[model samples]
Target chain A: MLSIKNLHASVEGKEILKGINLEIKAGEVHAIMGPNGSGKSTLSQVLAGNDAFEVTSGSVTMNGENLLEKETEERARDGVFLAFQYPVEIPGVSNLQFMRTSVNAMRHHRGESEMNAAEFMKLAREVSKQVDLDPAFLKRGVNEGFSGGEKKRNEIMQALMLQPKLAILDETDSGLDIDALKVVSDGVNALRAEDRAILMVTHYQRLLDHIVPDFVHVLADGKIVKSGGRELALELEDRGYAWLGIKDDETAANSAN
Target chain B: MTTANKEVNELIKREYEHGFVTDIEVDTFEPGLSEDVITRLSEIKKEPQFMLEWRLKAYRRWLEMEEPDWAHLGYDRIDYNSVSYYSAPKRKEDMPQSLDEVDPELLKTYEKLGIPLHEHAKLAGVAVDAVFDSVSVATTFKEPLAKAGVIFCSISEAVRDYPELVQKYLGTVVPHTDNFFAGLNAAVFSDGTFVYVPKGVRCPMELSTYFRINAANTGQFERTLIIADEGSYVSYLEGCTAPMRDENQLHAAVVELVALDNAEIKYSTVQNWYPGDENGKGGIYNFVTKRAACIGKNSKVSWTQVETGSAITWKYPSCILRGEGSVGEFYSVALTHNHQQADTGTKMIHLGKNTTSTIISKGISAGKSSNVYRGLVKFGPRAEGARNFTECDSLLIGDQCGAHTFPYIESLNKSAIVEHEATTSKVSDEQMFLCRQRGIDMERAVSMIVNGFCKDVFKELPMEFAVEAGKLLEVSLEGSVG
Candidate 1:
């Protein structure tokens, strides 16, 4: 459902993603695990077409359409969703209004009729229940004064509402307790469609234990150095990243030994 | 990215829609100001002798007063002598008894401004008094209002027909000697709306006035007065728009409202004067003075305004709560864009025991414009058990714009309670990116956030006006995003 060829990216004159090549087919779930500063987040941002990060040399295609040539909003309309690592807080815009505008924009792009307020509210309530988010939070400002877990659930609710073809989850498990982690996993598992693809990016193996992936790729120094099955996450967790001979700036190799 | 910013800029650079001029024969005075000019103005209006004396008194007082410079604004010195004191569309010597007798071109001008003078027009529930340039051309629904024992007419007509009521309330709340602009407005004010709700009578419909500046080089000085008698209630709306011009025009208006025992008055304004070009070349300089007085026990007054235009705006709508247990409210939203500058707010004075007041102000600044909020709350010695609450919030859209707050509070009553809150925020980069990532464009996102910030003030406006106010904010903030 998604394809990337030799993705090279940078931010403010500093290279971040050296060369990222990945491919995922329909109905498969892929997880990319890496240590800090390993370009896991950069890949998600690049796929979403964030203006802060420039693709120095690369091409991304979603559903056979050139995604990199589209604007940020156009890419979202084209069914590419990126759940942000740190969602922004907009003080004045309500979450319901935000969701309605997004849903209508996508529907308009697909030559479908816009959803009425009643239907929109009904869909919002139904999907929010799946993510364990209270309906009261929908009337509040977008992510304003929200806790980390609530924000993650809200992101998932948005993804469920849009029903994107490709969804990239960036650090969705961070700052969540065991209960929230379980709820988030349940929501993702419910959205497992035969024609959709999910790419999970995380630094730890804890999230994989709930929403296990079919294939695991270890990203080191901006490239996929190893590929294996779900067991690769357990191996990386038992033996720290130093066992892979990758020395970070901190060089905390001895502590792991 | 540069191309996207260019598209955003184009979206913001919308042209002023009501810039067309009407072709009609006009009666205008020469460019100058003098006692003889005021005498001629009163004589032309066929005012009572007392009215002539009042104008002369105001003219004498104005000559001795200097223009106040305390407001934070920059502009070339105004040439009072270079402005025509009066301009009116030529018509029958007598006032038009109905819309049919009014000049067709003048009626067409008002129609172009979205105000229909015919009684059976689309604006169903409201009665409008259309003021063109320097004189009132036509006032609709006067007969129905007269049937309700409500007196609604032009100030000039009231001077001739109901001299006693006009004499009793005129300038009582806002005296001519109040300030520089008030003095000038009193000296040369031509015509505006006058409304009076009789004792125990509720006005049947909303009363409104639409002021338009059409003649070139003419200064519009409007005088408005409304009085709600005992056990009465009324809602009055004021709206204004001017034609585009290269040279800056002057608009100095004075509005005074009075509420008597157990009476209530709600006054709202939507001001859309010509706010010069994007480069700040020429526009209207709007300096207005508006105040309300609660003169009897249990009286109430509220002021809701949306100010969006004018190159340099200096205004303060205030309230004097002099009646025991009286209430006052002020809700305002002021926006400045493309080199516009505005310094506006309200003043609340508690003079009687248990008087209460609430003030909510929202200011938005975009482009290179500057928006300032200056408010004052005072509690007199006899204002025992009085209370005041104030909230001032500002939103900035671009780096080149500016927002400022100046609040002054003074209390002499030991038992009085006063509270103030202020906050400043911006359209953060993170917020913009989040909206864009959610499939919304830059302009729509900025406008939505701005309208949300101003929701409190917008809710205070009348239902139809609230919608217009929201659209006005969106149009004014165009070209402000990247």
Candidate 2:
């Protein structure tokens, strides 16, 4: 239920995503793998309505609604979720307060009454257990002084709490330990269902082994160069991006013209 | 602009909520200052001979005192001669003997500000001395307080009824020569609350005073004195508000407290005067002096204030720890927005052995306002084994606002220990983006964050007042986020 056509984006007057096209129907999981400078994170941020990235020429639609025209918060209420690679720390706002406010916002948009504190607390405890986080973290400031692995798991916990229709996981496994990776993957696996789509952006194939994807695409110089089935990931894992005839960083990216 | 910023911009434009004027006839003196004016004021109140003599003496001292300008403030020179000294509601009879006798319009004015003066209301149980303009029209829970051996009434009444107590303690802590503002307040002060807790008695209920300035071109000078006799304990609260006007009105108030042997006193204030318009056209210039003296051994005193308004504020509530093993504490939360400027803090003077003090100050500045924290902690040679701890934190919201800290510390005894810490922070854009991404409204996010920053100070306020203080900060911060 998501479509991106010839999406071109830039930051600070320098182009990043150039004429990339992708479409995914419901109940499908798509993984886009690329090198360090292939604009993998930039693509996710642009879709999340980050104003820093200038969407020069393209169109994005979620269920036929113009996604680019909506503000960041409106997109969030419209079931769009982005798991940040580096979670921001709000030193004084408790994690429980932050999550409850977000969940209530989504429920309000769906014409449902806000949940009371007691009811919200029960749901939050269950989600925290699923992500292997201690209940005590709820009382602490949001992501304040959290370990790298805990922050990644907190992002997964938030995603599970929001239950978005279009979940964009941007390098969720970058900083997780092996055990935390297992817990986070289980949470993501539980999110799969009918009428929902998932997009995973990553640089490693290790995450692919946990929650296998239906489709894999190789992104290089802001363009999806190759598309294949699940086995393509294992092939690319054996031979690096150079074997795919794509330079990682020093390519200048002039080919976008 | 993004939708989050756009929504906040609208809220930032909200006008001050308590800006309406009360329509009533008033007896106002012409705008000027002289010995004749002070004499007329004392005569109108029909004070005792000693009281009139005291006012004349203070007026002479005020004349000799050049208006002090050493504060960290920038403002036009105040024309003292151009300000009317006395303005009170026109009354043809004696003071109101009961709620039924008070003018309905005056009661309505208090009602519009969410302060119910009727005895049946729950708030009336707190014993409020409602000071309007330059005179006190009503005081609550007088009989119950009197039964408890607590003398609670207006200062004017105290001078006439409890002359011995008034003569014993008035001006003893902060004398007429204390400072410029205190000198002015002592000379031409109109009316304020006077509270006395008898020996070995705890006040039956919290005492509060609400000061309202409704007349135009009149400066409000309030003088308050609270005495806790030996082995007594009491808590007093003061709140002030004024109507919106284009001419800069002046508010000069002096508050003094005295604690006897083993006695304790707690004072709290929430000052929300008009802070002028966005371009700084008109508001109140609040210059107040408040102090307490712990003269008896083991006495304690604490000051808590939440100041959120005023075009320009200059106040420093202080404590003199003269009793052995006495304790002093100060907690403050000052927020300034629009064109407001505030320079407020506290002072702790240790003169006896084993005296201790603690200070926690939080200043929040938004829009084009400026907030400053100026504090002093001094230990004399007799203060052996004394200690003091201080913490100051500032949070800046917009790019144009400013925050400053000036802490003066002095110690004569080698055994004295002083610890001070200061920090400055901002509401970063990334933090805003994070909250906005969660679909929380802009106003809610800012208020929540600011409330968290001020949680430490709000807890020190009384139970009901803590809630009001939080809401006041939210209202004050409105339209400050653009």
Candidate 3:
């Protein structure tokens, strides 16, 4: 469902993602684990079409369409969703209104009529139950004054509502408590299907314990140095990333090779 | 990315949409400022002798007054001799009693302004009085408003029919010599809307005035007066858009509002005068004075504005809380882009005990534009236990633009409490990224954030005006976000 070849990206002229090559098929879940500044967040931002980062080399495609050429909204409409690490606080726009607008924009892009207010409210109510988010929260400004756990749940609720083909969870478990993590993982697990893919980016293997990955790739500096099964995350958790003995430059060179 | 670039490219080629002058015939007065022009304007309106003398007095006062240079705006000197003081659409000898009898071309002009004379066909329940150049083109929903004992008509007609009312409240809030523009407007003002809500009656519809300037080399000096009697309530809206002209056109307007015992008045404005081109060569010098007075116990008055146009705009819509327990509020969102300059805010005065006032102002500046917020809150000696709260925030889209806030608070009553807060920040790249990562594009994201920032003020606007104000912000910031 997704492919990245030699993806080299940078922000403000500083290289972040160097030669990241990865592929994920439908129904597959992948976990990319790395230390801080290992280009994990950069990878998610680049995939979501953030303009601040310049893709110096390579390409990304989703379902055989050129994702790099699309605007951020177009990319989302094409079924790519990114759960941001820190959700934005839009002070006066209610969560329901934001969700409705996003859904309508995506639906419009997909050549579908917009959902009316009644239909949208019905859908929102049903999804709110599944995500265990308070229905009252939908009427509040998007993430304004919301606690850390509420924001995470709201992000998951948005992903569940959109039902994207590919979901990128960028450290969705960072600030969540144990119960919040369980609920978020449960929401993600419910959406797993034969035609959808999930990419979980995390620092600790604890989140992987809830939403198990089919494959795990270790990213160092800006390049992926190791690819293995779920056991790879457990191995890295037991032993630090130094177990690889390969420096970041070596990994870049190796990826180039 | 492509959408942002497209908007930027569009801004690069932005042209004034309503810059053409229709070839309609007009009865025009000679250019230049003099007692003769004032006398001619008053006589043309067939005003009472007292009004004529009043205009002559204001004209003499304006002659002695110098144009205000204190506002944080820069503009070339206005050539008073090059502007026609009075230019009205040529009306028939008999006034039109119904919309059908109005001139078709005049109706077309109002239609182009989105203010058709059919109330049922209009959106958002806006009963409009369309003023083209200097004369009222059509007034809608007159029958329904008349049934409610609400008198809405052209100021010229009101002076003839309801002379007592007009004489009682004409300059009650903002006097003729309040400012240079107010004095000028009082001197040669041609025509504007007059609204009176009778005692104990709540106006059933939103009263709006759509002012358009289509005559060449003509200055539009419109004077508006709205009075809500005891136990009455009313909401009034004013919107202005001028056809583009290469030479700067002067528009000096004065608006006065009065709220009596237990009355509430809400006034909103969405000013979209023709902003100059990127080089800032020519546009409207919109100098306006708007003020409301709370004259009786427990009276309330609120002013809300969404200003997005004009090359140089200088206005301060203020409130005088004279009654005990009266309240005054001002909410403003002023945006300037592409060489526009606006110096606007409000003034609140507390005279009686336990009066309160609140002011919230948000300024957005982009593309070398300058926006300033200057406000004053004053408490008199008898204003015991009076309170005031003010918050002013500015968002700069680019480094080239500027935003400033100047607030003055004075209290002579020892028991009064006043607090003010202000902040200045740019639409940081990080905020944009947060929105983009959620699949929102840059321009929409910027607009969303900006709307959120000004939501407080937007909510204070009438429903229709709120929607128009939102769209205006989008259009004003078309190429602003990078």
Best by TM-score: 1
- Model 3, A1-257: lDDT tens per residue? 89999999999889999999999999999999887789999999899887778999999999899899987777887888999888877777788878887888788777899999999999999998887888999999989899999998898999998999999999999888899999999999987989999999997788999999999999988999999999998887665666876343432433322
Winning model by DockQ = 1
Query: lDDT by residue for model 1 over B174-261, one digit each (tens)?
Result: 9999999999999999999999999999999999999999899999999999999999999999998888899999999999999999
lDDT per residue as tens, model 3, B130-175: 8888888788888889999999998888999999999988877778
lDDT of 1 by residue, A135-253 (tens): 99999999989999999999988999999888899999988999999999888887778888999999878899999899999999888888888999888777767778775543354
Report model 3's TM-score to 2 decimal places.
0.94
Second chain TM-score per prediction?
A: 0.97, 0.97, 0.96
**TM-score (chain A) of candidate 1?**
0.95
Candidate 3's C-alpha runs over 4 A off are A246-257, B1-20, B118-126, B438-441
Model 2 agreement with the true structure over A113-215: per-residue lDDT tens digits: 9999999999999999999999999999889999998998898899899888888899998877889899999999998988789899988888999989999
lDDT string, candidate 2, B32-141, tens digits: 99999999999889899899999899999998998988887889999999999999888767577888888989888888888888867738448889999899988988
True contacts kept of each: 0.64, 0.52, 0.48
Looking at candidate 1 chain A, the ten consecutive residues that score lowest on lDDT are A248-257
Of the candidates shown, which would achieve the greatest lDDT relative to the real structure?
1
Q: Score the docking of each candidate (DockQ).
A: 0.57, 0.47, 0.40
Steric clash pairs (candidate 1): B12-B478, B12-B479
Regions more than 4 Å wrong, model 1:
A247-257, B1-11
